[model samples]
Target: VRTVKPELVFEIGFEGINKSSRHKSGIALRFPRILRWRHDKKKEEADTLENLKLLLDPSNLSPDK
Candidate 1:
């Protein structure tokens, strides 16, 4: 595997996300895939950790919500 600098950003699609101790970020994504490269967006515009954590909210996971 080739490792590179975090110079690019991509729009990722995932089935689910949850908190996980196994990961350094304490978050885990389920079946994540690269939806597309976000060429229109700068790397700085990527979603923040706080924003991602919002997905873990119980209210957000409800289908009726």
Candidate 2:
């Protein structure tokens, strides 16, 4: 999924998710599902620590606060 900035998400509503990591070594997804249209969400109200962790390796995910 391509990570989008908050400015545009509000214009279209939080309906996007993507990977922008230039980390060529990481395993790329063949398809990423947009779990929800998230019209009720703000940028910070979108996905959370758990949401992002699904796409990351344990070593690379947010291990600490």
Choose the strongest candidate by lDDT: 1
Question: Model 2: clashing residue pairs?
Answer: 1-18, 1-19, 2-18, 2-19, 3-18
Q: Cα deviation of 43 in candidate 1 (Å)?
A: 1.0
Compose the digit string of candidate 2's lDDT tens values, residues 9-51.
Answer: 2322233233435433233334444454556666766544455
Cα RMSD of all models vs. native, in order, equals 5.8, 8.6
- Give the CA lDDT, 0 to 100, for residue 33 in model 2: 49
TM-score of each: 0.76, 0.33
Model 1 — which ten-residue stretch has the worst lDDT? 56-65
Give the per-residue lDDT of model 1 (tens digit) for 1-65: 34556789989999988777666665678899999998999878898878998789564453323
